[model samples]
Target chain A: MTKITFKDAAGAARTVEAQDGSTVMETAIRNAVPGIEAECGGACACATCHVYVDDAWTEIVGKPSQMEEDMLDFAFEVRPSSRLSCQIKVAPNLDGLVVTTPAKQG
Target chain B: MTESIETDVAIIGAGPAGLFAVFELGLLDIKCHLIDILGKPGGQCSELYPEKPIYDIPGFPEVSAQGLVENLIKQIQPFNPVFHMGEMVERVESLGDAEHPKFRVTTDAGTEVTARCVLIAAGGGSFMPKKPPIPGIDAYEGRSVFYAVRKVEQFRGRRVTIVGGGDSALDWVLNLHPVAERITLIHRRDAFRAAPHSVNAMRELVAAGAMDFILGQVSGLKGEGGQLSALTLRKESGESVDIACDDMLPFFGLTMKLGPIADWGLNLHENLIPADTEKFETSTPGIFAIGDIITYPGKLKLILSGFHEGALAAQKIHRYVYPDKRLVFQYTTSSTSLQKKLGVG
Candidate 1:
């Protein structure tokens, strides 16, 4: 199992153990983490699961795909670090991934 | 006033479950009129991700969302179900009593449908435009700010600012350019998700200095009493710029909301209608619900589960539509009457 941490806008962090092949959004939803709506259920269709990867973990998590970037246009307050958590896969390499959920998702 | 449509069953929503319900009700010789807020059929399947593939649909190993919707529409074509598209249901009045229940469903577009029974197959409710998180933006809504361009005359001789990089933004920018005194297109990044042709047209206009293209996000709105004066935009460099405009249109796509359905007086559990597993009927007699908008003991939000619920609900609805006629369970493969209804006999 890979360990991942999710932090809310207020800096409250919750770390959970995510199984390999699952996504960060799935882990967040499995753990009942607040602020991650995942309205499209990880199809990367809706941008409600928008998250800001920590600056240190940006290189490790990698950039979003072209399709995800198109969908990100629907999100609010997007930044260089903004990525839809549904597109980020959970792996042993990303065991210590840290991401912050935005205050409001469009 | 136009004449109201009379049918045996009035099914709300044109999604997968609702479309399948028409087939189920049609097999029982029940005519139906489908009402949906979207202009076309396939609610979320067509609206959200039409090109995306779905795996869980029965029989089909894998099918695109639009592909499944097309098959469902074709499967129910023999029923000749009438469609009232692009209208939101405003009110549902129970006209008849418990023994012989009837409902008069009204839409915002002034369309009325009276039926022996009403079925709610609305998956996750209606889709509405997603609003940005700008503080105090609600005050300017329907006044200085608009989600949809109802009238092109409203932007005449006005300074308009269109936000977002999608088709809605670019299309409106090019459309309203002739009427508006000035058009400003604002987006967070340089890349656009709109059609390449529209993007090129916008860039050509920008090159000609006909309009302004700014790279930023709307951070705040400056206005008073539902009138917009200017909007504050934050750039990627952490710089803020205030652009003076009388009207602002932000196209951030759509989100599902349980709109108007909550006020219908049905017993709701966490915004979902509570229905029985057997008939899938709501607390209000003759009014049934299925699909994601309903909750039962083992309710799964899958399309197959909705198909099952709809099939069972049709059994009960058949009794209400033809109270004098006796119902005989028959399979389409073995029953000539069922095959005749399918137009395959």
Candidate 2:
């Protein structure tokens, strides 16, 4: 099982096992993590499920789609490393990725 | 990770979107924690315009927005959705073993909770508009400043100013004509943005002298201690005029936008979430966008579309989150059967 570590804005960390085919957001939501709103219900529309992709895995995580780029404009506290948690689909290759959820959600 | 509270699902907003989601989850026998900022469950239907009649919603010939919401709640009764109102969510966290897991949620009131999945269904409300900036207008809210009026039945026999260019503005003019001694319309634009028939009706009222157009914008509000007596208007040519009235209804359309969600930069096209319509997934992984909030190629943001989005997103989520569930959308309807029923086979 792949392991994904989720960190909150307050620096609290919780790790969940990323099943073979599920994305990190799915794993986190199924686990009931605090700090990830996922308002769009995983769609990029609501950036409630915001996180900083483990920098080590940036190159592996391809760029977001144009629609995501547009949606991110509506998110809070955008940063160079800011990524919507819904966008990152998990695969066997991503074994020990770290991610963080944003505190505020609309 | 060490200490966690668990729930099947945690929903926010309790609006049409959130409520519908709970109903969908109930079909799978999943439990939920539904939260809303309002004191009641119907979201805007119960809070914003409880008495206002609504058209364009499918299924019911016609009903008040409140009535429709109530009906929906009753129709989805099989779901047995739980309710938590007057609460706001501030955080989300995840925990558990790989196969079976749990999630934790924190609220603004400092309550820590958990859920397996989070669904946000906050409907079309972000912020409500306040009184437009008018000269000397700061003092007369209780005496004159009203955010919204539920029933216009009592406004008869009073002087009124309806300051908007939308459908409600026009409707108000018609609704209040019989009762108001004087009705004036003050708009920022020369043309009305409301439906053509409503606009025409208001124009007919103007021609009939039931209402008059002031041809300017309200600049300020001026009144004595607690009584509103006059309005300050700014003309297109920088002129100011004062009009006397007992009530003012600014019909200028309100602007809507996403709130704190805008803080996180997700790939967006227009204000809608750019998602793969087929998958109902956004640029963000693990997160799926649904309803009117998502738009992509050949997509429309309507209630129908949102319904489809919610249903589709759930399927995708179920598969992504519950690999063991192994669900699929199998249907019995076929083109051949449809053709045979129509005698086209």
Candidate 3:
């Protein structure tokens, strides 16, 4: 299992344990994390699961794909560090992953 | 007070599969009541892509999604299926033991439906729009801010500000431009992901001074009691512009959720309900699943496939509804009794 931390819009940090290979969005929804709406259910079709990867873990999470970039344009407050949490798969190496949820979902 | 309804079968979802289930159950002298979260039938075919053409339907070479839904409604008309629209099935509990089980299905509307069997045809579950992130935007909802245009008349003579770059936003800008007293469209960039023709039309409108297109983002709202008087926009240059608009329509597109079905105790496989290939029954006895919600080894998510599953489910449902009677195959065209039920005899 991988441990992930989600900082919600209110700046409250909540840590959750998830199985390796599960997407961050899936873990958030399963644990009832407040910020990630995940309306598309990880289809990557909706950007409601938008999150900003913490700068410390930016290198670990990698970059968003071209399709994800296009979808992010529809997201609210698009930032250089923004990513759709659905595209970030949890892995053993990403055990200390920390991401902050956007104040508003686009 | 919660309303109580008793039926032979409670079909959850009014999509093609659920509507078709009514016909199949009706042929066997069984009555059915359907519940749907959407106000109307057809599921994604109607809700997502109603005008899109579907070439894979068995009969016609090509038919619009809405046309297929209309045809399904007409085909099932003889059965006179009862429908409870605009309600979400919240919880499904088995009332009896395994051998002679009954289901007590409840909707979010506080309505309880007790049935001998339950069939779930929820196509990809519920359709929920991706909400835009504007701080305190919820305060203006249902007053000056709207996600869906339930009726065009609501925007008459109102100053409307549309946000987004997708088809819904552009289409509404074009549609509401005529009747709306003033229109302002806000996007982070000038580029749009909609059709080229729509983009060109929007540009034409901007050129004609019929509508204002701004390259900015909605940063603030001035409103009270769910009513908006003005919208504050932030441009790329860090300048704030306040536009007077009483209405804000934001369409971020929709995503499907499994919704309340996930809470039910049925066995789930990868976010989908696991159903037996024989009768499409879920892990729980007397509860069946069909359409996009069900999963099997080689199951295909298609309208025709769901139709076939509904037919097989009806066959199994007969045994549950009438334990003493043996099911006999009868052709609808030849059997007077079946034809009479179809109102065709």
Q: Give the lDDT of residue B47 in candidate 3.
A: 72
Per-prediction share of native contacts kept: 0.83, 0.00, 0.33
- Error in Å for residue B114 of model 1: 1.4
Clashing pairs in 3: none
**In candidate 1, which residue pairs clash?**
none
**For model 3, what is the error of residue B84's alpha carbon versus the real structure, in angstroms, after optimal superposition?**
1.4
The candidate 1 chain B region of ten consecutive residues with least summed lDDT is B1-10
Instruction: Give the per-residue lDDT digits (tens) of candidate 2, residues B175-246.
Output: 778778988887754666568898898888888876788777676776677566878887766788999988
Per-candidate clashes come to: 0, 69, 0
**Top model by DockQ, which number?**
1
Q: How much does each candidate deviate at the interface, measured as C-alpha RMSD after superposition?
A: 0.9, 11.7, 4.0
Q: What is the lDDT of residue B279 in candidate 1?
A: 95
Write the residue-wise lDDT of candidate 2 on A1-106 in tens digits: 8888888878888888888677677888899988776654564544556677768887787676765554453454445566777888889888888877765542
| Regions more than 4 Å wrong, model 3 | A1-106, B133-215, B218-251
What are the lDDT figures for the candidates, one per model? 0.94, 0.64, 0.87
Off by over 4 Å in 1: B1-3
Ranking of all predicted structures according to DockQ, beginning with the best and ending with the worst = 1, 3, 2
